[model samples]
Target: MLEPPDADRLYAALLARDPAFDGRAWVGVATTGIFCRLTCPARKPRPENCRWFADPRAAQQAGFRPCRRCDPLAGAADGTPDAAAGGQGLARRLMAMIRADPSRRWSEADLAGLGLDPSTVRRAFRRQFGQSFLQMARGERLRESLRTLSGDRDLIEAQLDAGFDSASGFRAAFARLFGHPPHLMRGPADLAADWIDTPLGGMIAIADDAALHLLEFTDRKALPEGLRRLSALCGGRIGLGRRAVTDQLETQLDAFFAGRQPRFSVPLRLHGTGFQRRVWQQLQTIPAGQTRSYAGLAAEIGQPSATRAVARANATNRLALVVPCHRVIGADGSLTGYAGGLWRKRRLIEAERAYAG
Candidate 1:
C-alpha cells in the first residue's frame, strides 16, 4: 500500500506524458499486465489502465512486465528507508551486525530469535531485496572476512576469524567472489569515502569500511567490482567497519550535499591504471565548484592528444564527487558521460556551481 505522489502531480505528468518522472515513479496497467516509467516510449495507454506504484519491483511482483524502453532493472531511485528496512526493520540492524563482524555466523534459530521468522525473512528479502537473506548475509560476511584476512592476520586465522565454521567454506566463497584466494588481497591502510544526496537520489561513500575504497554512484555497473578491489586491497573482510575516517567522511558528505564548499582532506585509496589515475588526480585540482573539459585536463596532464583517453578514464572513475569527474564536461560546454548517470552529474554540478557563485 505504498502511496504514489500527489494526485495532481501524477495527473499533470500523465496529461503531459512527461519523461522526467520515469524513474521517480511508475504506472502499472492492470488491463495490459505491463508496468512503465513515465518516460517509457510506448504509446500512452488510457488513464483507466494505469495503476501507479512508486517503483517497478513492486509492480513486477504484482505480475507486470517492464516496458522494454524503460528497463526497470536499472534499479529504483535509491532505496528508501522502508525499502532499506524491507519490513523487518532489520536491514540496518543486520547490516550493523554483519559490518561489526562480517565473519560472524548466525544460525537460522539465532536470526529467528531476533523476532524474525527465518522463512518469512528469506521470502521478504528475496521479494524486496532480490536476494535471499542467506545470500545477502553470506556476501556481507565474506566482505568482512576478506577485509580482516588482508590485514596482519594470516590466511587460516583470517578464514576462521571471518566466522566460517570451516576453512573450506571461506576459501570457496573467496575464490568464487574475487576470482582469487585471500593472499591476493593487498593495499595501503588509508580509508576513504564521501556521501552525497542529489535531486535524483542519495548514495553512500564506499570503502573497506576502514579506509577509502570506491567513491561510487550507488547505481553504477562497475560498483561491485570497485568494492571487490577495496576488499582485496584491505586483505580482510569488509562489513561496515568502524573507523574515524567514516565519521569525518560522513560529515563532509553531509556538508557537500547541503551545498557547502566544504574542505575534505581524507586520504584517498584509488584503483585504476596509471593513466586513469593521472586523469583523476588532475580532476582533483579542478576546484570545489569549477569545471573543465576533458581536453583541458588532458593538455594539463601533458597528454594533449589524449583527450579521448582522458574522457574514458573519467568515465571509468569509480569515485564520483571526490575526484570531481562531474566537473569535467564536453568541449562544447555540454555535459557528457558520467558513470553515476548524467542526471546525478548535472545535479552535482548545478549544486556546486551555485555554491561557487
Candidate 2:
C-alpha cells in the first residue's frame, strides 16, 4: 500500500521503459484506468495522468485494471509475491514452512510426507527463484549456522545447528559457499565476508579492518573462483563477519541508491596488476552520470593502444559501485559489457543522474 519514495524516479523509469524496475515497480495510468509494468510496451502516459503503486493489487484497489498489453498480474498467477505476505500459493506456503524451522534439513521425503511432489515443488521454486526449493532450504539452514559462527560455538555445534549429521558433510557444504573448509578459518579473522541486500540484488562484500576487499553481486559467475583465490591469498584470515569498513561502505551504498551523491570514503584494497590498477584509478575519475568509452578510458591512462586491456580490467573490477566501472561503455555509445549485468548498469547510470550535477 506504500508508494515508492520518489515518484519522479519511477516516472522516469516508466518513460524509459526501464527493465530494471520491471518486477519491482508498476504504473497505474489514471487517464486509461489501466495499470502496467514499468517495462510495458504501451504508449507512455502523460505525467499528470499517472499514479504509482508498489504492486498490482494496490493499483487494482485504486480503481485501475491490469493493462492488456503488459498483464501486470502475471507474477501473482505464477505464485510470486505480489503482496508483502504473498498469496496462498504453493511457493509462499513452502517459504512459510522454511521460516518456521529454518534449521531443519528438508528432504524430498519430508516434502512427500506433506503430500507434495518433490519435482513439483522444485519447479515452482525454480520458476520463482531460479533455484530448487531444496537449495533454498539449504541456504536458509546455512544462514542459521552462519549466525552461530560469530559466537563461541564450535564447528561441531555449528554443523548440528545447520542440521548436518556429519562433520565432512558440513565442511563440504561450507566449502562450496565459502571456498574453504571450516577448519581453515580457525585463526583470528582479519577479513570478513558479509551479505548486503540492495535494490538491484544481493551482493557479497568482503573486507578487512582497514579497507574493503571485494564487492560483487552474489549471482555473478566469477564469484566462486574469486572467493577461492581470495581464500588462497588470505589463508585462514577471512570468515563470516563484517568490519567497520563494511559498515561505512554499506552506509554510502544506501545513500547512493537513495539518490544522493555518495562520497565513497571507504578505503579500497584493489587486487590487480599495475596496469589494471591504473585503469581502475582512471575509472574512479569518470564522474557519475557520465560514461567513458573503453578507448577513451585507455587514452586517459596514456595507453590508447590498450583499449581491449582496459575493457578486460573493467571486467575484472570486483568493487561493484565503489569504483564505478559501470561508467565505461562501447565507443559507439552502447553498453557493451558489465559484470553486474547490463540492466543494473543502465539502472545505476540512470539513478546517478539524480545528483550527478
Candidate 3:
C-alpha cells in the first residue's frame, strides 16, 4: 500500500473522474462500505464519506467490498482503469463478432439488438481503435469481398457477398480502403494484403512470400497512398491474402505487445531512398523503451544537419512496429508526429516500458 494525496485533492480527482488518477488510487465509501475507482461513473460520495487508498488491496483491507458498479477488482491485475477496460472489452467482443461473420453489415440497430448503446459502442471503438465499430465491420466486409473478387469469382457475387445491394456501393467502399475498385484489384497477384488485429487496433500487412513490404493500421490516412505505391512497385499485383512473412510478423507482434522484447526477424523489403534507409536502420537499433530525437537520429545516420529530413523519413515509414517509428520523439521529448496517430504512439511507448533496460 502507498500513501494517497491529501484528502481534498483525492476528492477533487474523484469528482472530476480523472483518468490520470486511474490505478493510482482507489476510494472507499463509508456509507456504502464499497470501494471504486476514481473514474467510476457512479455517483460521487461526499468528501466526508470518502476514504482514499493508494491501491485496491488497501481499500479492500479496510472492510470495503469492491463496488459492483465500477468493478474495481477487475482492473487489479494490470491496473487498467475500469472505463478503458470497458472500451477495450467491448471492442474485442465486436471484433470477434465481425470476424465470425465477415459478410454481415453491422449497424446501430444491430448493436442495439445486442444490448449495446450505439453512441457508447461508437466511442469505445474510436477510443480503443481510432475508428468506429461500424467502420471496422464495414472494412471486414470489404476485405471478405476483396478475397472473393481476387479468387476470379464474378464481381456481382463479390458485391452481394459484401452485403451491398449494388455494385457501385461495393466499389466505393472497396476503393475507400484500398485506393482501387474491386475490378482493378482482381487477378493473379504477387503481393498479398491481410488484416492483423492488435490490442490497439486493426492493421493491414502486405507482404510477399519472402519479405513484408508494408504494415500499417487500417485507419491510417497514409494507408491508401501506401497501397497505391505498393501496387505500382509490384506492377499492380496485389490481392487479399497472407503469406508466411505476415504470419511471422504477427507472432513477433504478439510477443511485443505481451511485454516481451520481440526479435523482429521477418525479412523486410524497405522501399526508400538511401538516406531514408539509413534512418530506418538506425531506428531498429534503438532498444525498446528508448526514444530518440530527430536530430539525434540524424546524427546517428551521419547526417546531423538532416533532422527535418529525418523527421520526414520517419513520417513516411510504412512498416509500423517493425521499423519502430514510434520510438522517435521531438527534441523536447514530446511525442511529435506519428503517422499511426499520437494516441497509438503514446500507448506503444507506455507498453514498451517493460522492456526498458
Query: Number of the top candidate by lDDT?
Result: 3
- Give the poorly placed runs of model 2, Cα more than 4 Å off: 1-20, 26-35, 38-54, 57-64, 68-70, 75-140, 163-169, 197-202, 240-242, 258-261
Q: Residue 353, candidate 3: how far off, in angstroms?
A: 1.6
* Order of quality (TM-score): 3, 2, 1
Full-model lDDT for every candidate: 0.63, 0.77, 0.80
What is the TM-score (0 to 1) of candidate 3? 0.76
Clashes of 3: 0
- After TM-score superposition, the amount by which residue 265's alpha carbon in candidate 2 deviates from its true location, in angstroms, is 1.3
Top-down lDDT ranking? 3, 2, 1
lDDT of 2 by residue, 93-124 (tens): 88878879978998999988986667766755
Off by over 4 Å in 3: 1-88, 150-152
lDDT of model 1, residue 253: 72
TM-score for each of the candidates: 0.48, 0.71, 0.76
lDDT of candidate 3 at residue 79, scale 0 to 100: 48
What does candidate 1's lDDT look like per residue over 1-357, in tens digits? 012345445655766655435445677877778887666667777776777776556777779987777665443234444332233344445655755765667778877687565775564454434445666667656656645754577777777777787777887776665445555544443443333433333344655444555665444556656666766766645442336665666677767666664455766767878998899888888876688998899999999999999989988887677788888988987778787767565556655754566
Off by over 4 Å in 1: 1-18, 21-211
lDDT of 3 by residue, 205-316 (tens): 9999989999998888888899998899888899777799989999988887776644487899999998889988899999887999999999998899999999999999
